[model samples]
Target: LKMGEFSNGLFGCFNNCTLCLITYIAPFGIYFVAKTREKIREQKGIDGGFGSDCLVHLFCPLCALVQDAQEIQPAAQAESMARE
Candidate 1:
């Protein structure tokens, strides 16, 4: 959970700096989420499952990344408008 928050905060910093792209950030976020879940499963001796608690913790950051990506759409559209 803390890892997810850290990843999210990092993403937010990248977004604010305009240094990261969704194409890159999304997969990295997913990878971290998977790794966290794997660690939790190992620690708890549980088979892999949905793990709603973990997902709940991760959802907000993931949503924020998606929202940030969506924000680029209007900018792209404006660029296309100018090109025409």
Candidate 2:
């Protein structure tokens, strides 16, 4: 969990098949993808702007979605574990 590094590679979507499948099948999943990117930006202090986010999603939708999911998953898991 490095500050600015992605825990999962862009093509490593199968590592979390559920997320991959959801992003692939969900029609409203674009909203989810945008939120995920925002979370990554905040959590990692990323400087990439809205335009870049849009371009990434427009050009590489699935990969971007999967990567965003992979980036946020670890932090979410850790928070859930801490709650217990």
lDDT of all predictions: 0.56, 0.77
Q: Candidate 1: minimum summed lDDT over ten consecutive residues — where?
A: 48-57
Q: Write the per-residue lDDT of candidate 2 for residues 1-84, one digit (tens) a residue.
A: 647968888899999889888767553555556666876898899888755776677679989988888888898999999999
Q: Write the per-residue lDDT of candidate 1 for residues 1-84, one digit (tens) a residue.
A: 345335466447565543466434444556566566555556557565544434533666576345434655677899999999
Candidate 2's C-alpha lDDT? 0.77
Off by over 4 Å in 2: 1-32
Best by TM-score: 2
CA displacement after TM-score superposition, residue 29 of candidate 1 (Å): 0.4
TM-score of 2: 0.54
- At residue 49, candidate 1 shows an lDDT of 54
Clashes of each: 0, 0
Model 1, residue 12: what's the lDDT?
75
